[model samples]
Target: MSMYVRVKRQDQTVFLRAEASDTFRTVKVALGDILSLVLDDIKLYGKDKETVLEDEGTLGGFEIGNDDVIFWGQRMDGSTFEPASGN
Candidate 1:
């Protein structure tokens, strides 16, 4: 079954459709396509904004659910942004 996840960055939010088996890399590619961003520069965090979601992991492995909110930010110089919590 397909699910939807909300990817937020600052004031912008994007809803991505995905499956439980979809890898983070796949999601990043989709997000990159939508926002015209470089794949390697995209970084994703879990709901808490502290857990970095690795590219090789699947959504189910991360326990991400339908309607769950994940954070997105850009990677710069091998460092990722500190996302604001409780968005």
Candidate 2:
């Protein structure tokens, strides 16, 4: 079983799907691929906060479900990517 990770980048949100058996590893790799973040540069946590998983944790242990959102260490700010309109 595989899971999909939805991440927001700039004006778009991208989905990276990988095996549920390899959640953490796959997510780090996907983050690296999509957000240009290296595996070492990524950190993840569930909404519950209790199930905190990091670089060395197993994917199955996380048990990610449908619409289970995860957050990485990528920086997203309006001032950086937003284009300025003529005032």
Best by lDDT: 1
Given candidate 1, what's the lDDT at residue 11?
A: 83
Q: Write the per-residue lDDT of candidate 1 for residues 1-87, one digit (tens) a residue.
A: 999998888888989999999999999999999999999888888888888899998899989989999888787567765553447
**Poorly placed runs, candidate 1 (over 4 Å):** 77-86
Each candidate's lDDT (Cα)? 0.87, 0.55
Query: Residue 12, candidate 2: how far off, in angstroms?
Result: 6.5
Candidate 2, overall lDDT?
0.55
Would you estimate the TM-scores of all the predictions?
A: 0.88, 0.60
lDDT of 2 by residue, 1-87 (tens): 666665443344557776666657667787788667656654555545334467666556666665566554443352222221110
Best by TM-score: 1
